[model samples]
Target: MKILANDGIDPIGKKILEDAGFIVDTVHIPQDELINRLNEYDAVTVRSATKLRQALIDACPNIKVIGRGGVGMDNIDVDYARSKGINVVNTPAASSHSVAELVFAHLLNGVRFLYDSNRKMPVEGNSNFGGLKKAYAAGVELQGKVLGVVGFGRIGRETAKIGLALGMKVIYSDLFEGPISLKLNFTAGVEVEVPVEQVELAEIFKQADFISLHVPFTDKPVIGKEEFDLLKDGVGLVNASRGGVIDELALVEALNSGKVSFAGIDVFDNEPTPRQEILTHPKISLTPHIGAATNEAQERIGEELANLLIEGLKK
Candidate 1:
C-alpha cells in the first residue's frame, strides 16, 4: 500500500513502514495541491500543518485512511471523513510527557520570576523591570500554592503529579459536573473537594494565585475583559492550552498595569507564527507552540499514527 506521510516521520518509523511492504512518501505538500496528488496513495498522514477537508478527501477515491500524527484533529474534517468511510486515527500518547514538561517549565519560570528578570532591559534605560522585581517575585510559590487544574486529562494529570511533588495542593474543575474520585485525596490547607463545575469565572480569577490553563480552544475566548477584572493584581496566568483561550489584547493591558504578574503562553490564537506584536510583547513568556515538539515525542506520534493506518488498512 502507498502511504503519504506529510511533515515526515522518524527514520525508524519510515524504515518500519518500508519493511512492512508499504511504500511511504514524504513531501511537505501544500494544501491546495493535496487533492491532485492524494489519489496516488492508499493512506494519508498528517500533523497540524495539513488540512484534510472534504474537498481533498473527495479527490482521493483510492485513500482508505487518514492518520493524525498528533492528538488534536482540528485540522481534519472528521465528520466528512466518516461519511467517506475513511478511518481516522491519532497518536494520542505520543506527546504526553513533552507537553507535561512545558507546563512545568512555565510554572517554574512564573514562580521564580524568570520572565520578569532582565538586567539587559535596564541597560536601555528600562528600569521598569528592576523596579518591579518585588511584584514579579511575589508570584505564588508553587511549592505551597493551590494548583486548581481545570482539566484532569493526561497533560492535566501529569501537571498535578508535578504539583504534588513540588508540595502544591492540586484540585481540578471538570465540566461534566460529576465528581471524579481520585486514588488519593488532597485536603492539605486548601479544601479537598470535587472539581467544581463551571467554576465561577470570578472565583477562578479572584482566588487562583498561579493559574495555569490546560483547556482546549473553542471559537470564543475563555478569559475576557470581565475575567481579567476579577483577577487579583499579580496573579500569574499561564496558557499552555490552545490559543484564543485567553484574550491577548486584554492580557497585554493587564500586564502593563501590573494586574497580571506574568503570562506563560506556548500556543496562540493564530499559529504557524503569530503576528509580530504578540511575539515581541514584553510581559509574556512565549514559545513557538513547542508543547509537543520533543524528538522522542515526535517519534512516538509517527509510530502510533503509522500503526493506526496500517491496522485500518488490514481491516
Candidate 2:
C-alpha cells in the first residue's frame, strides 16, 4: 500500500512504514493538488499545516486511514471521516510533555518580562541600562502561586506535574467529575504521587495567580471578557492550546488595563498572520504555535503514527 505523508513525516517513521512493506511518500502536495492526487494513496498523514476536511475526505475513496501526527484534529474533519468508514487517529500522548514544557517557556518569559527586555535591550541597553534595569526590576516569582489548568487531559496533567514540582499549587477544571492523581518522577528514580481536585471554571479564574489553558478548539472563545473580568488583578496567563481559546481583543484590553499583568501566547486567532495588536503588544510574549515542535515530540509522534497506520491499514 502507498502512504502520502502530506506534511512530511520524520525519516524514522518513513523508514518504519517502508520496512513494514508499505511505500511512503514525503512530498508535500500543495492544498490545491491534494484533491487530485491524494486518492492515489491508501493512507495519509498530516500535522497542523494540512487540512483533511469533508470535501477532501469525500473525494478520496481509497484512503483507509487519516493520521494526525499530533493532538488536536481541528484541521481534520474527524467525525465526518469516521462516518464515511474512514479511520481517523491522532497521537495525543506523543507530544504532551513537549507542549507542557513550552507552556512554562512562555510563562517564565512573561513573569520576568524577558519578551520586552529582549526587544528593547538590543536598542537601548547601552544608553539606558539603568532605566531598563529599573523597568524590569518588578518581576515576580512563580513559586507558591496558584496555577489554574483549564483542562486535565494528558498535556494538562503533565503541566500540573511541573507546577507541583515548582512549589506552585495546581488547580484544574475539566469536563470529568472526579479528582485525578499525578505521578511526578525525578532523575534519581524517586517518584511522588499528588492528588488534585477539579474546581469550577469561575473559581479557577478568580483564585489562580497564573492560568494556563489546555482545552481544544471551540466555536467561541472560552476566556472572553466575562472570564477576564473574573480574574485576579495582575494574573499571569498562558495559552499554548489552540487559537481562539482566549479572546485576543479581551486579552489585549485586560493587559492594557492591568487586569492581566502579562500573557504568553503560542497560538493565535489567525495563523501565519495574527492581528497587529497581538503581535505588537509589549506585555505579551509570543511564539508561532510551536508547542509540540520539539525533536523528541516529533520522534514520538512519528513512531506512534507509523504504528497506528500499520495497525489501521491491516484492518
Candidate 3:
C-alpha cells in the first residue's frame, strides 16, 4: 500500500506505516499541488490544513481513503469519498483531553484579558510583576455565571461538566428537544440541562455570561450582526468550533464597540491560517486550531486511520 502523508502527522504514525512496507510519501506542499500527486498514492492523510474537496477525491481514482488525524471531518469531502468507495476514519476519542484543556485555557484567557496583558509585557526588561498583576487585575470569576453551550457533542458535554464543577450553571442548547440522553455525575458539580427552546439563540446571546461554540456549522453562520445586537452586556465569547459558525465581520464590529467583552478562538473559516483581521484583534485569545495538538492524539489517529485504510482496501 502506498500512502501520501501530510508533514504534520505524528512521526510514530509515519514510522509504523513505513515499517509495515507501505510506501509512505511525506510532503509539505499545498493542497492543490498535493492533489496532482494524489494519483500516485493509494491513500492520503491530513489533519485540518488540507481540504479534501470533491474535486481532489474525484481526480484520484486509485486512492482508497483519506485519514483525518483529528475528530472533526469538516475539512474532508465525506459524501464524495464514500461515493468513490474511500474510507474516511478519524481518531475521535484521542483528542478529548487536549481540546478540553484548550477550552479551559481560552475560557480563562477571555475572562482575564490575558492576550492584551501578555503582549505588553516586556520580555527582555526587568519590569517587575507589573504585567502579571495587570493580567489578574481584570480577571473575572467563573462561579455562579451562566455557561451556555451551543452543542452537546463530545467536547460540548465535556466542557459543560467543567462548567458545572466550577460552581457555574450549565445550560446546554442543542437542536434536539427534551433532556440530553448522556448522563453524568459531578463530585462537586451540578448541571441544569435546558432545551434549545427554553432560550432561543438570541436569548443565549442576551443572557449567557459565557458562551462557548461546540457545534460544527460551515455553510451558514449561526451568530451574526443581529445576534450580536441582542447580546447581553459584558459577554465572554468562545469559538472552538468552525469559524464560519460566527460571522467574523459582525464579531469584529461587536468587539470594537465593546458589545462583546472578550473572545477565545481556536478554529477559523479558513484552515492552516487565519484572516488578517482576527490576528490583528487584540481582545481575542487565538490559537491556530491547536485544540487537538498533542502527541498521544496524533499517534492514536495515525494508527486508527492506517488500520482502517488497510482493512478498507482489502474489502
Global lDDT of each model?
A: 0.75, 0.93, 0.76
List ranges where model 2 is wrong by over 4 Å: none
What lDDT does candidate 3 reach at residue 98?
A: 70
Per-residue lDDT value at 62 in model 3: 88
- Candidate 2 least-lDDT 10 residues: 175-184
Off by over 4 Å in 1: 116-140, 177-202
RMSD of each: 4.7, 1.0, 3.7
Per-candidate count of clashing residue pairs (backbone under 3 Å): 0, 0, 0
Tens digits of per-residue lDDT for model 1, 258-289: 89877889888778768676777767777778
Among these predictions, the greatest lDDT belongs to 2
lDDT by residue (1-315, candidate 2, tens digit) is: 999999888878888999999999998999999999999999999999899999999999999999999999999998999999999999999999999999898888988999999999999999999999999999888898999999989899999999989988889999887566678999989999887768999999889999999999888888999889999999999999999999999999999999999999999988979999999999999899999999999999999999999999998
Reference-based TM-score, model 3: 0.85
Model 1 pairs whose backbones collide:
none
Off by over 4 Å in 3: 15-21, 123-136, 177-200, 270-273
Cα lDDT of model 2 overall? 0.93
- Candidate 3 or 2, higher TM-score: 2
**Candidate 3 residue-wise lDDT, 74-149, digit = tens:** 7788987987788887777777657777888988877877787777566622574765675568678999898888
